[model samples]
Target: MKESEKHISHFDIVVIGGGASGMMAAGTAAARGKRVCIVEKNNELGKKLKITGGGRCNITNATYDIHALLSMYGKAHKFLYTPFSLFGVNDTFRFFEERGLPLVVEAGNRAFPHTHNAHDVFRVLEKYCIDNGVVVMLDAPVERMVMCRTKARIDAIETSKGSITARAYIFATGGASHPETGSTGDAFHWLKDMGHTVTPPSPNIVPLRTAESWVHTLSGVSVDSMKITFLVDGVKKFHKTGKILFTHFGLSGPLILNSAHTIADMLHEGVVTASVDVVPHLAHGDLDKHIQEIFSEHKNKNFKNVAEYIAPHGMAVSLMMMPGMPLSDTKVHSITKEERKHIVHTLKDMRCTITGLMGMDKAVVSDGGVPLGDIDLKTMRSRLVDNLYITGDLLHINRPSGGYSLQLCWTTGWIAGSCAE
Candidate 1:
């Protein structure tokens, strides 16, 4: 053995990458009276979890129906049934709420801790590990897995700290997204070397950049109820309704993030664009009548003075100031009938060209990991390597934002921890 490899430490289970799944798996194993150690590259764990949902931490989507929740994962739904059936969303709620971190459901059935502090969620997992006697090795970046080729199992792993030998190993190193949080694609390469088919990852759930500077000025503004339609060369492709948030670069929020993948595909075909209807529920006649009432209410007022009443909250300035929009100096009563119709049209069809999606750096979740065919999702164990298991973003599953990603971590981690023999 080499000098570093000679310093071997033994454990009943060794979990790599102390983000969401690794921490869960280590704590679960330790609770079962196994000697467990969690290795993390970062000085602290849960860097990504800490900032998820803007630090409020959307713990899981409260979709109680197993079939309904699984559908969100796209193609991997079939592979996931076994794991989730064993440790499903209800189990997730029981696990945390019993431990004193109660979760509350909000719009879209998205769940968060009542405190809404992500750090508290991390603390719950951390406390689980500490109470169960799991050893944590922070800042110990793993170099490579030492595989027993003939036995088809991981014999040990080389890390900056030293070599670690475990009866079973769980890899939860996450996929490439938010690299600043330490979820780099190091494990994907290692799995490829082991002959696993690692899919090349791309930013899946991310924000879109737009061509309009007017959109940029509305940064930090969000429309609670709106509809956005995507098109290619002026032909409608698809549309979704919910909420949309404007960023300095473009558009975001749950609605936009979920649409990014499809929009990305559309971008490849031709020039992609979008039309935002600020008041989707209002028909043309209804909206026009509403605007007429607002105009009559302030008959002598300048257009800009009453723009806020017609436009979405906090967006009147930017929308009214658009190049072709009615001049702010124009009196509301003097506004031409054609201009009145134009205003209604603009509200219904707020046009903007989609430039592109933000890269991996801004991605909430990236798809690409070992295909489900190579995983026994029943136990999250590798089909080829008997004693090796995979969890979290390491498994190729395409899911939208909101709480699906973290729920995957919890479900897979629990099953792997329970079944790792």
Candidate 2:
């Protein structure tokens, strides 16, 4: 087929989804002498990326060991090793730093620009694309992909604005998380229709809503270094130790979001229960002894007055309301051993009912997309379609926060763009 006859709005590459990966792929391809165009549904590019890491944009983790980095991901760890080996953390660090965006590694090795602005990350990519002659079609949503069966290639992509044709196509539309940011699982449906296996998308790094009403009162209270354990069918299946934030609805933060996946799985099968060890560092016996000592020392004082030192600030009042303790009438000297045990148990195991997940609107990342087995990891090119490639959260790769997701985007985007020819 003639080059002019085969295309409508012709380019060397047409990248669908103007997200992190899409921008990266377009810029990289354009840099490599490939004419590139990006079709973005939103009026602005990198809307989601702009707000990532609470607007700081956790660029990448500082870890260089491929094995240790792979271990961060659950089952998807093995699939990512090949890609990481090609363009791992070191490449990600250099990619930004070389572009005048120096990165700083924080407490958990989470890398962010020295300015800590997500806009800077976007600026670097935007500047790179413009400098390399990449065309960006803003407010253009890809309606459908037209594939030529005889050639087994994507001939053209129909967008809301118009049609564009290219020799190669890259999908980096992200996942269903933060639909307000324009990610609504459109890529998954598009890929599924094109004969690729797409996993059912679910809320991954999202908050969990609890059934308890009192939890709402504790909104904005963050517990650091707490161990959260998820129970399925009365069996403790998942557990993680980190920081968690109590919201008006329930719980969130790094630990809670990661545990939500396990909780969702258990909830699908049956009922699930969640327990938080607020003072995980303290042994039960040690905690009990500590409480006993506090009570003995404050024997002459009122029970309510002594409770403040043992529990978290503002939590003592809530604990005093539970079963035995009478905040108004009981004195520390009159408090029985049984009541003290209850307080100790409450302090150790603060239980909450797992009502439901917060949904994609609040998710940090969504879990579901084109199955990994359906795409070639080396090139990020589709196994079914000859010229079609997938990248970012659109590919089913389970990962946690702290810059792993963005790194995946960078690696896969670079690979897809490099292989576009």
Each prediction's TM-score versus the true structure: 0.95, 0.94
Each prediction's Cα lDDT score? 0.91, 0.86
Candidate 2 lDDT (Cα, 0 to 1): 0.86
Inter-residue clash pairs, candidate 1: none
Task: Write the residue-wise lDDT of candidate 1 on 1-421 in tens digits.
Answer: 5776456689999999999998999999999999999999999999998998999999999999999999998998888888889998999999999999999999889999999999999999999999999999989999988889688888899898788999999999999999999999889988988889998989989999998987998999998999999999999999999989999999998899999989988999999999999889899999999999999999999999999999999989887866567799889999988899988998999999999999999999887889999988878889988888999998899899879999999998998888888
Top lDDT model: 1
Evaluate model 1: give its lDDT: 0.91
In model 1, state the lDDT of residue 12.
93
Q: After superposition, how far is residue 303 of candidate 2 from its true place, in Å?
A: 3.6
Worst 10 residues of 2 by lDDT: 1-10
TM-score of 2: 0.94
lDDT tens per residue, model 2, 1-421: 5544534578999888888999999999999999999999999999999999999999988888899999988888878888898888999989999999999999789999999999999999999889999999998888888889687788888877667888889998899998999998888887888889898788888999987765667788776788888887677887888888888999888878777777777788777777777778888899999989997888888877887888776566556655555564578778778877877888777777888999888999888888788888999989998999999999888877889899999999999988887
